[model samples]
Target: MSDFSATGYQPVSVSDPEVAALVGQDLPEDAFREIRDILFTVKGFDLDSYKDRCIKRRIAARIRQLGFPHISGYVACLAAEPTEQLALLEALTIHVSQFFRNPTTFMVLEKKILPALLRTRPAGRELRLWSAGCAMGEEPYSLALLCDELCNSPEQITIYATDISNDILKKARQGRYEPHRVAEVPDSVLKRYFTLEEGFYRLNDRLRKRVRFFHNDILNDRPFHRVDLILCRNMLIYFSPPQQEHILKTFAAALVAGGYLVLGRSETMISETRELFECVNAAERIYRKKADDVKEDD
Candidate 1:
């Protein structure tokens, strides 16, 4: 059985080089297309937007779960076990978010990035923020609490929190959470922004009111443009280099010059997009958008 503790199913390291190499290594071309087509046409799930390695390994995991021998078998099995396709998608999305994840990163945002952004904003001008890949609402709510503490008027700050899953977005809209999910939250933040209900902590509407939750697919969906800082932490690891580059371009296009881009601690900008953003705090994965002298290519 998989490790299912407080963390739920503990996935085996998908980052292992050897494991990564196994992705799409032996799959037949026709079979691969069959699986992708089934996911797209029948299941209404688009696999092309995601990297092949990500799709293949996650599909392989589901194949193991169902005792299927290969992609061909898995594709056939999907007809009989329709729910299996959903199981594959749930596996692929990879939600590991928690409140105040990576304390050092948030510390940098609070002390450096937010301060700089505030200083630049004209008085009464709204400071905008977007939390991409905001899973179950912990990250966005954490940002909300931080804004409450840092901003002179929390109402002046507007936050957009987006995730790809409608199921996940529904839970985010509720703003309710279990204790273990909030274990990393500070006592002060908890006392101020949350109301304890039974055993779980319910985030106050005051905090929730500041943020707008919605569903967005980072790859193909229309990216939010203009404004200020964007936090896309721990999300690029699931994408291919090309996908990562496309995402970086999207972020660059979205942020105003001098606006900040905060990525996951493990993620970084490649040489291909170095000119897009200047590194502000390398260790904290904070980058400031470099002024675009030329109009961005469509």
Candidate 2:
């Protein structure tokens, strides 16, 4: 029902009643499930964990991009071309993200959460952070700059940034952004952390080296444990309810006592995950892991 034009490439829509009828009437919902399941089983990527409405929109985008008439045509293309699987994965996970995407949330994190974590940890100790679904490296890079100011050395603060799409991860690793991408960053901070080119900005090696990028599927992969903070902002809204609950539990397992977890301002903890964390700044969607709970892997 949904389509994928938002990826920046407008696909030419195709109309074929025969193909539409086949994809709709003959294959039915079972066909969709099979295609989704095979993506994980054969290719080791799980697309089915996402909400169906989101899945359908992405599939529609792929269909249009490849000039397929309907699901049947798209399925045929996938069956023939292995590379299409990667394309489909990118389409599904593609989201709009930017540096300091939400200023108030980052402000809350800087003013409240970071200070509390620093005070609790022992002096001269290393700090760990995870940036889930760290699209194009902006979120983790933003965190790295903040940590650089607080910690003794850039090496002391390790930011593990993970995303499901390798294509996006590659872009993130490059640490290069067009002018529009850096528009929100203050000019002074920009001069300190990034080198501005004719039209693109390149994040300095000091900031980039601190963030270790990984091609991780958060839905199925094990998250890094014993992290002092996990920034999973804006990613959960795309997943279904059960998936969200599972991720929150995994985040809980990964955090140390009194660790902080940050989400998008629009996102909040589900009723099921409320016990694991207490809201530190509800207005900014920041939560701290309960000090008393034992760490258990999900």
Candidate 3:
């Protein structure tokens, strides 16, 4: 998941000395475990899967803001107040995304990947794509726009977008975005596909209808099957190595043989999963699932 900031809360840096000091204080291990259990019981969020330093630092920042001197106090607050739990979950999991987030990655997809995949597709078959961790619908809508332009018929493509937060999924289904969220979008595309409403740019029904938004937790939920492409960007960095491998293996299983996987610019395929996929473009962090006929490395 990408970094999230609630209203009135400044973003916390993991390396900040203040956060370090807070975490370094009399925070007992059991208290931390209690906090994790409370979060799981209330929100179903597996805090243990996240990198300890990052999650702890974010919690520490919240603790600092709420004027709690220790982790125990915050644990009590979380157990007593459901609203605080949701606010913390939002702070932890919410991501702000834009249309065509990384131009270069989309350029690679448009110029190279899409053309190649379409050429190899059998006639009468639809191209399937999944945007995992799609926040606010921008990522999937961006894919829909690209597929719409490339394919001869809109029905020739299917786009599935999922997020863990039901509240975010509801917003994503609306297919509405602020102007800044669409700043990267070309003016021509903006005019053709979206309507300028009172203030927000509302996606036209054509593109809006193209995407299917759902609530999915990649960790515990079953993945979509036989997908042609999967875009899960900037999400793995927050997880521990084992959790990262688990998610990557899930992605690998979901993709068809020779299907593509595109990750965030900063993410890389972990060593444990390197045998499952072959790197296609290192610069853009694109990879292709190895065909079944290929043998794994010793």
Residues 1-298, candidate 2: write the lDDT tens digits.
Answer: 4454553433433255535544443434665676777676556555654544556645665565565555665677776667887777777776568888888777776776776777777877778899998999899988887777776665767899999888888999999998877778889999898987777899998788889999888878888978999999888877667778888888998998888899887688996799989987888888889976746442
Tell me how far candidate 2 lies from the true structure as C-alpha RMSD in angstroms: 5.6
lDDT for each residue of candidate 3 in 155-174, tens digit (9 for 90 to 100): 77889998878888888888
Clashing pairs in 2: none
Model 2: lDDT equals: 0.78
- Candidate 1 per-residue lDDT, tens place, 22-128, comes to 34344445655777787666555556656446566566666655544345556787766767766666777867778888888888878877888888898788988
Candidate achieving higher TM-score, 1 or 3:
3
Residues forming the 10-long window of minimal summed lDDT in candidate 2:
5-14
* The best candidate in terms of lDDT: 3
Model 2 Cα shift for residue 155 (angstroms) = 2.4
What CA RMSD would candidate 1 show? 7.8
**Displacement of the residue 15 alpha carbon in candidate 1, Å:** 32
Give the CA lDDT, 0 to 100, for residue 90 in model 1: 73
Please give the ranking of all candidate structures by TM-score, highest first, separated by commas: 2, 3, 1
TM-scores of the candidates are 0.76, 0.82, 0.79
lDDT of candidate 3?
0.82
The TM-score of candidate 2 is 0.82
- Candidate RMSDs in order: 7.8, 5.6, 7.1
